[model samples]
Target: MPELIILLLFMVAAGIVAVEIKDLLASVIALGAVGFTVAIGFIVLQAPDLAIVQIVIEILAVVFFVAVILKTTHVDSTIGRPYKGADIFTFIIFGVFALAFLYVGVRFLLINSSAGFEIAQHYIKHGLTETGAVNRVAAVILDYRALDTLGEATVLFTAVIGVLAVLRLEGRKK
Candidate 1:
């Protein structure tokens, strides 16, 4: 229970930080932190494979984003801005939204869990018979779900190409 609470808190903090931070570098780091935190939660819940996948993909995304940030910009931001009433009001609104989302998320998670576990369990029992893969999740991704994986790869490729194109433009300008 305490572990779940900590995870929830991290999620909320990540959300707030991602939204509230003005620095691109800080926001990218926070995004990576959130992803790794979720991966840890997944591991604690007995999904090592899922945890690994999340960590890998998140790390990849962070690499891509950070690489782009490095190639495009470099600067430290000032933190000396005077606080305003609007900042406080916005933070309060964001806080309320986060709390509401947390409540709904926890409730739905508790309610909808068994149905999810049922599908996983079904795969565990009959996966070998149907797909001939020892790792059920791998079977889903590599065999039965190759289409989704292919789409994801294509997206990643496009992102990489986009990054390269932007960097190329920068080089040409110089």
Candidate 2:
């Protein structure tokens, strides 16, 4: 809805900032902003599992980006630059957005917990019989949620490939 459109716009802006920023560290921060925004979008879309995975992956990506930038870049652009009002403004904006997301996520959880529990109960009660699996966990994972599990696996594999590609590029430069 409107919230999704706003999130998409903010994500695009962050992406542009990441591309246009002169400072490497700042650019990486902007990139992280884009990733975090996407995670929020996932949460808003009622996909908490995807949001959790995206948040974890985004954290790892940001860490890797910062480490690589620090190691490879010789010049430090931020050394003599004084803190600006824009910095404080950006921090405040992010804080507000974080609070909003937290509120929405909590509200969603409160509203959906009962429904989620019922689904879980159903799975537990019938999973083994319906799936012909030995255990409830196996039946749920391998039969009931197989597509979701496969999608998550694919995402992880793609992230690993991306990291490997970056490392390979760094090696080629050496």
**Candidate that scores best on lDDT:** 1
lDDT of 2 by residue, 1-174 (tens): 999999999999999888767688888999999999999999999867778879998998899888888889934555556779999899999999999999999999999999878988988778777887766656776788899889989998998899788667445455
* Residue-by-residue lDDT tens digits, candidate 1, 3-80: 978997998899788756878788889888899999999988987899998999999899988997998863445444
Error of 2 at 126 (Å): 8.5
Full-model lDDT for every candidate:
0.86, 0.85
Which residue pairs show collisions in model 2? none
The Cα error of candidate 1 at residue 61, in Å, is: 3.2
RMSD in order of candidates: 4.9, 11.5
Q: Distance from true position, residue 26, model 2, in Å?
A: 0.9
**Position 167, candidate 2: lDDT:** 66
